[model samples]
Target: MNRKEFLAKLGMGAAFALTATCLGSCSSDNAGETGDVDFTLDLDAAANAELLQEGGFVISNKVVVAKNSDGEFVAATVVCSHEDLEQIVFQNNIWRCTAHLAEFNQQGEGLNANGSNGLAIYQTELSGNMLRVFS
Candidate 1:
């Protein structure tokens, strides 16, 4: 190839490489979690103590933390399966995704109006002042 054509091709290739690298790093890691969702939060403080109440929920970092009727903690992704919207809230012990009226149980087994897959649930361990949530 001519020198000018070779240089142009090289520049295009470099641009493509840079774009690929940026896109690769842009993929959502979602709250600094690895492939596994092992994360911990200190919920024993007065500010966070609201999570212990029945039907209470705290949403942060793409995850929803809620307490069931039995005062047990449950964790799940806040994204609604119906439209992938992050409008999840807890009310009356049920997780309702306000984006499209999708609802899930304490075990995250409920479904959206379209009958698609339910919310993704994470296992929670509440001990002392630490709450560890994982899947």
Candidate 2:
């Protein structure tokens, strides 16, 4: 059938319902929800061995913890402020959302239009081989 005939047979309500379902599935239930986050990681552990290297990062408890180029630990919520997607990654000393490419600085300041809402930042403390990340 032609496009119009096909659409007419499908019905607008059905089309809208399908569209709504697709949109809903693309959203996150944890949107805008950065829960109370206070955790610790052992740098000596193999799971967190990346933190020992400069410019390495890990995602834990929905938080992106990274060791910047300065050999310092920095952290931010993995949830992107733009689309509320858990796709934040640490790269080149910047927090970027892989979903929409939103960028934020180490201090959680938004650096682009998609990231203007800013990200949630946490404090980090390193004592011995333990790294503490807290909101």
Model 2 whole-model lDDT (C-alpha atoms): 0.83
**Which segments of candidate 2 are over 4 A away from where they belong?**
1-33
* Whole-model Cα lDDT of every candidate shown, in order: 0.69, 0.83
lDDT by residue (tens digit), candidate 1, 1-135: 999999999999986875665454333313222236777778876756778688777875678888888888888887765546678788788878664456777666655432145677788897787988888
Worst 10 residues of 1 by lDDT: 26-35
Please give the clash total of every predicted structure, in order.
0, 0
Residue-level lDDT tens digits of model 2 in 26-111: 44333244878899999988999889889999989999999999999999998887777789999988999887677889988879
TM per candidate: 0.67, 0.76
Worst 10 residues of 2 by lDDT: 24-33
The most accurate candidate by TM-score is 2
